[model samples]
Target: MSTTPVNVQIPSDTEAPIIADFVEHALRVAYFDRQHWASLPSSDWDAPGVYILMTADGSSRVYVGQARKLRGRLQQHNNKEKLPWRRALAVKRDTTAGFNTAEIGYLEGRIAAELNALHQITVIEGQTSGDETLPKHMMISLDAFVKSILGALRLAGLDISRSNPQTLTEDEQPTSAPVPSNKPNKTVTVADLVSSGLLQAGQALFLSQAGKEAEGSVTADGEIIVRGVSYKSPSTAAAKALELQSSNGWMAWKVGSQSGPPLDMLRQQWLIQQTEEAEK
Candidate 1:
């Protein structure tokens, strides 16, 4: 439904009413409100509100949190301001876990009622009693969720917080790092690559060659871009030049990274989970 936007100024007094303009946008998109209350002003629209905004990871940990104004809370998620994991999971297609996102976003009307009835979660005034925080609604911090999902993904050692968001830290990026076992980084392995659901097994590829053209059947015209992805063929001349095996399809696959660890480490993590589940 068409609605007038609420130009809510940051609450000057703690008691000043705060409205959800940004959130209204989200609500509009989510519900496609072209019919009911299409002409209502956000200020006078439904008042009691609650929302569950969360990000899922390969481990499938649901970071459940609530907000007095759900629209405001959801806005916080679209940006990288404080939530770093979005940069990680959103980019590298999570394959290790599954999610039913909005597992609860739609129930805002009822959930808000319940929370209002019980007085749980919060819509606290931040350091600025009046300067409105992001939605004033409570939210699940990225750090908090990472701890939960990382464990579920079983990569107890992987730290998403440490990944650099900057592009091309080095001219020659290495895909396989030295995992004490000389295996590839589990997240970057071919199987893991396959699991990412971003590429088909043996899809067109091209390893980065810097000053030279990419080699083999795959070349500059290849479908995959070397942007942040590893491109070292398991058996490339570059891999062989670096003394890697010719049959090293790992090197030939050349995703977009260079010189990291093996990609199968995450698989081992999943195995541990299966073992745990089997014993149960």
Candidate 2:
């Protein structure tokens, strides 16, 4: 038997946090602020999966559960004003053969147990062990699923695991070029990059997330195009590609290939040139 290692990439702070690590069945876990959840189209929520709801005020309180159809279940949670949940982490398979009842139940049970053991966050529900009678083969297959879910939760800034813990500082966080304004900090626009020869107009841009890929191109002006829509800011274009409210396009997007340098790196080079010229 042979195994291939998969890399887990942390999302930029400016982007909605999602951890889609290597797992069978195309497992993906995405974080959603409560408003983000509410804003999603109805079709987005119509899936069978497990979810963890977290309190809004940074309370570390959370509830883990599974549903056959996430839309109805999440809506019910929304109505319970007393529940005090402010955001959610949803897990689903991107394959045609989605999770069955027992599979999600098993995942929910295992996920809750993992959270409970961590003792870093409070698990609001009692006895989350669901469908424990799965066959041996199924349990073996689900082991990776459990690992990926916990990994996703950890990467999403939850202290749900002890392995490879990470803490990012304010300056260390990734951010796009400041939004265009009449102010002086506007020197780092895509147009500026083009003028400075850091990027050529009509050059291709790439962004890959959770095994999915998107392509955009630098327009002649400062904007970029994705799916025929032109956006004024890279972060906005990245957000559009990811279907999220915001993303640090500087970090989320690559110059040309999946392995290309992020826009932030190019922006830094431009800034360095500016500093040298100022000194001269």
Candidate 3:
């Protein structure tokens, strides 16, 4: 499937009971208090996804869960007052075909882990490591989706993390070619890689590690575009897509498919040919 750009719309006022919609990818997150949640229509949240209930008090307690139908699952929480959760963030895929059981299970486990790592909030829920047996590509897609959810939480004034979830940090930006004092640098672009027949225009590329996944495409001009942003080199593209300080794109991204050979393999082949010609 062709990768689409992610566009998330968040509300300006976090105090208001509102639903911040990620319109393009249909990753919808509704933030509301008890009264606002009770007033929402059940039909709108009938899809499968994960939900988070958090305390507004200074306790910073949270509960993460998954369900087939968010409406029914959340309703159960509303009837029971044991958790003392004052605010809720109900997340659901706003698409015709939404998440499956296994997908939500995977998200539940992943989200729980992310929260635990934050060290700010104490998860009130029991130990839940959901089913993680999913395809590589699917896991990558879900990881990106999870980022969107985290972004929404950040917008709602939750101190989830110190860094912005969506924005690439200054250190994460792609570095320029190194220019030596004696000689001018020969900048290597995706065009150079493709001219060597190592890559094709419009070829799909992906990076996956530690349950995080990112996708990009090789353009006709030899630049790799990730999340609608273009980069001059594969390393920069991989770093930007993966939101890392730096990455060796040639090794980080897989060409053509998720299970395909690492880009470095093709780079090695091209370097070998260059060496052979230089020796002659």
How many clashes show up in model 3? 0
Off by over 4 Å in 1: 1-7, 11-13, 23-163, 169-280
Shift of residue 154 alpha carbon in model 2, Å: 1.2
In model 3, which regions exceed 4 Å deviation? 1-17, 126-128, 162-280
- Report lDDT (CA) for all predictions: 0.29, 0.68, 0.69
Q: Model 2: clashing residue pairs?
A: none
Q: Which stretches in model 2 have alpha-carbon errors above 4 Å?
A: 1-25, 162-280
Q: Against the true structure, whose lDDT is highest?
A: 3
State how far residue 6 of model 2 sits from its true place (Å).
7.5
Give candidate 2's TM-score.
0.50
lDDT of 2: 0.68
Query: Relative to the unseen true structure, what is the C-alpha lDDT of residue 78 in candidate 3, on a scale of 0 to 100?
Result: 87
Cα lDDT tens digits, model 3, 143-249, are: 65666777777766778863323322321212432223432224444676788777877678989865679998776556675654446567767776777767777
TM-score of 3: 0.57
Worst 10 residues of 3 by lDDT: 164-173
Candidates arranged by lDDT, highest first: 3, 2, 1
Determine which window of 10 residues in candidate 1 has minimal summed lDDT. 86-95
